[model samples]
Target: MGSPRAASSRSRAITEVCEAKLRMMGGSLRELESGKAAALEEEILRTDAKLEELGQLADAAARDLREDFEQAMELLQSTRRVKEHMLVDHRQQLGDVAERIAALRSVRDEGVKACEAADHAEMVSFLSKHASTYSQECWQLLARPLPRSIQVPLDDIPFEVAKRRDLLRGAQCSEKLARMKNEVLCDIVDALRQERSTHADTREYAVEVESLLEAYATEWEKRFDYACSYCGQVLEAALANEPYCGAMPGRKAHHWVPTDTAGIAEAKETARPQLPVAAASPRLKSQAKIRAISPMFRADSSV
Candidate 1:
């Protein structure tokens, strides 16, 4: 064994070395903690930036969708107006033709009865008195030119018969157009709804937008009721103050402007005053004509 003094000096040297190693380890631990904190702060900042960017993107998408929906509604409304006008005009033309036919038929019936009259002198007197009137009527009916669509007689049919065929063709054309308009409008509305559901990030926003659209459509329809005086194409009850016929000459300039739906609730509070109901029109009796036969034939179906 070594002496006591030498042993004590060796012990002091070992203690000093151990203390230095502990100090070095403590310093490394502090550095590691600081580095970790800095890295955590950087991650937090990046996450915040990403969240903000996503929010902005969502807002932009919503705005674009709303604008697109509005444009589609505008197009639908315009198309409805045009098709309604065409249907109204065609109905008027048919009414005029029917009136002329009834007049001609009355004269023919009188002539037929005269042929079978037991009194020959009375029959002759009746024919003589109406001869000039019948001739004038026939001349007037022939003077009117054929419609533009009847470019030539079909299958070499008589001119009068061809005119009647052209009129029938026009009626068929109107029916086809009304059907097509209804289809297009339905497709557009469905597409708008689908797009809204797809792009909206939140359910609440989607419902709100959908409600607004429905309210707008419903309100506009409620305010304007158009029934054609001639064709019986009734969209609804006639507007209390407005003329019922949409196809009346000099009425084309008048149009129904949809009430803005942004403040729909407010609009409902201050609705237009209802006027006293007018007497029912003669056309009201035929309201169940073509529109009743085919629901797709309605101009308002698309709207």
Candidate 2:
């Protein structure tokens, strides 16, 4: 295992980038908060002013109305009606604010819980305590969730099997997993198909969910069908989108995994193959032409 100090010192590049992203988001959020506060303040001021004006109007009318029964009764009834209307409006406004507060609290609680656990809680403990029940049930439905990429499932050799030295170690675990994944994928397809066929009879909301699952499963099949060129292995439908594996140790998984054409082109350019040079000496391919000895020094004079 690596030391904590080593791990902490490994890299700050990712953290620095994350900090920069958060700073940018914080700026926008602050601006939004300021705008919302300003708007709310203006609304409160308007409401206060309206209430004061209503009170002033009532006082001015009541100052001379007590001596007149008809005017007094009319003023009293009108004032009560206006007060009732204002009360109802304020109640509705309060209800809306309460609802918005509740929603915000729920969002903040859920988001924070997912991102940051209790100071003393370990990740495993937090997950065990607060993991989604729906997601847990879905995961439990599978025998074992397959890795996105190929893997050696049988890493621990059985003692009985190991007794025979002739037997191959880790005997094609990837291939076995591939077949198992295909079987599971077929089952998923069947289930999704059944859901779709009867979805029209189900509740409208349920039909949307069913259709989404059907689409998700159909997309998964495409990835599941694609094979790794190096190992000819396929991933389980649940994790079929990943395209890498540790087929050989000390080798990059993507080296054997076929990926995007652009990435392939880039790789080709980066590691271009060189042409072989001739084994003969460079002098043999020299551009200069060799000349014969001058005829002036020939043993027999020119006839």
lDDT of 1 by residue, 84-191 (tens): 676667667877877887888887787778777777886787678777787787778788754333232234323444566899999999999999999999999999
Candidate 1 lDDT (Cα, whole model)?
A: 0.63
Residue-level lDDT of model 2, residues 1-303, one tens digit each, is 898877776656668888999999999999988989889899999999999999999987887564455654565576667666766676676676566556555655664675575544554554565465534544453444332332333333234323443344434666788899999999999999999876743565444444444543453343224446655665346445454555755563533244344533443454321223334423322211111222322233321
Highest-TM-score candidate: 1
Relative to the unseen true structure, what is the C-alpha lDDT of residue 245 in candidate 1, on a scale of 0 to 100? 44
Sequence-dependent TM-score of model 2: 0.18
Give candidate 1's error at residue 124 in angstroms. Answer: 16
Per-candidate alpha-carbon RMSD to the true structure: 48.0, 50.8
Top-lDDT candidate index: 1
